[model samples]
Target: MIEVLYFAWVRERIGVPRERIETEAATVMDLINELKLREERYAWAFDDLTSLRVAVDQELSGFDAALAGVREIAFFPPMTGG
Candidate 1:
């Protein structure tokens, strides 16, 4: 199981801060497609990949990044510098 964390509007849209997911996804994009199939909320939250950011095992990664042995995945909006 992988720990999936949602932040900001993602959390609001998904109605949860985090969850444990049992997946057979090969990459982050595959994981997202799995989630998107689960519910409309997930679909909306992940609708625009360009407006979101992702992290795998606490390190920044892209949608095509492999999910092999990844224990955690986090999704959040892009951060802004002050």
Candidate 2:
């Protein structure tokens, strides 16, 4: 199972802060696709990949990043501050 976390608007859009799910996805992109198929909320939340950032087990990673052995995955908008 993978613990999925949502931050900022992502949380608001998904209507949840986090969840643990069992998936057969091989990568972050695959996981996002799976979630998107689950419902319209998920589809909208992940509609624009370029506007979001992802982390695999607390470390930044790309959509194509492998999910093998990963325990956590987080999705959120890009941080902005000076």
- Among all candidates shown, the one with the greatest lDDT: 2
Q: Rate the local accuracy (lDDT) of all candidates.
A: 0.97, 0.98
Instruction: For residues 1-82, write the lDDT of model 2, one tens digit per residue.
Output: 9999999999999999999999999999999999999999999999999999999999999999999999999999999999
The best candidate by TM-score is 2
User: How many Å off is the CA of 67 in candidate 1?
Assistant: 0.7
Model 1: per-residue lDDT, tens digit, 1-82?
Answer: 9999999999999999999999999999999999999999999999999999999999999999999999999999999999
* Range of the 10 consecutive residues with the lowest summed lDDT in candidate 1: 60-69
- Each candidate structure's TM-score, on Cα atoms with residue i matched to residue i, is 0.98, 0.99
Off by over 4 Å in 2: none
The number of clashing residue pairs in model 1 is: 0
